[model samples]
Target: MDLELEGKNAIVTGGSKGIGKAIAKELAKEGVNIVIAARNKDLLDATAKELSKETNQRIIPVICDTGNSEAVTKMVNIAIENLNSIDILVNCAARPLVKVLNHFHLKHRMTIFGMI
Candidate 1:
């Protein structure tokens, strides 16, 4: 089905694997150029190359640790530079905080939980 997405651009966080990668693939199939962000440069590059070949759409990769605000900002800037403008954003990046919470004090954990 045509999504009327030809020439559009998108940024998909955590797009090197799993759900985010699937979304990026679908968007690329719909004719959308994409900037896929993830922390692993090698994985991101591989995924980008594979998707670009499969969908015949531009797929750029940006290395970004989504838990870091500065990294996220840089990723956005890179995406914009590569794609010209962002028409879609898929925020699929996530951190498994369970292990981290185990190291924290109960009060800190409570604070973090509240934030979550």
Candidate 2:
């Protein structure tokens, strides 16, 4: 089951848990070094340590809120700084739109949907 991904680098957003974490683990098992981003630092750190140990690949944890453009930018910068270049990007980060809709005005909602 060689993916031929040895030494490749990737970033997996929302990777602290669930599907994203699963994806990161598989990629690491395939020999890819990864950066796993999430809002929860504790979860991110724990996941990173666990995955690195299990797969024998570099797993860096980065705290990030994907909804914020600045935070995303910072996360990308950190990934590039650590991994040198990005070979893959798995954008799994998301929030419930229902909760978001409750918090924004109509105009901002349009922006959220990229209609603005």
Candidate 3:
């Protein structure tokens, strides 16, 4: 059960809910500081608070839209600043393009994943 992850830091994209949240929880439980990124500020804040309390590890929440390169870059900078180092990276964000912009059509969904 010991992941030997104590004092490590991690970045979890789309970590506000579902599998990303679960991954963040496990990493936190292993004594890792977690930087969780998602588009919804409210949800990110709530999840960070909950995880920090549960795991007693530092949890940072970052508002990030992975579809944009600038946003992803900013998110990475924020994560590095908050967590100091990125020992683990979990790319679990599953963004529904349909709910995003009205006319912004993505030629490929893998573009976001490529950023990871």
lDDT of 1 by residue, 1-116 (tens): 99899999999999999999999999999999999999889999999999999999999999999889999899889988888899999999988898667757776867778755
Per-residue error for 94 in candidate 1, Å, reads: 1.3
Off by over 4 Å in 3: 97-116
TM-score of 2: 0.86
Better of 2 and 3 by TM-score: 2
Instruction: Please provide, for model 2 over 4-53, each residue's C-alpha lDDT reduced to its tens digit, 9 standing for 90 to 100.
Output: 99999999999999999999999999999999999999999999999999
Cα-based lDDT at residue 105, candidate 2: 71
Better of 1 and 2 by lDDT: 2
Candidate 2: which stretches are off by over 4 Å? 103-116
Error of 1 at 102 (Å): 2.3
Cα lDDT of candidate 1 equals 0.92
How well is each residue in 27-82 modelled by candidate 3, as lDDT tens digits?
Answer: 99999998899999999999999999999999999998888889999989998887
Off by over 4 Å in 1: 103-105, 108-116
> Model-by-model lDDT, in order?
0.92, 0.95, 0.90
By TM-score rank, best first, the candidates go 1, 2, 3
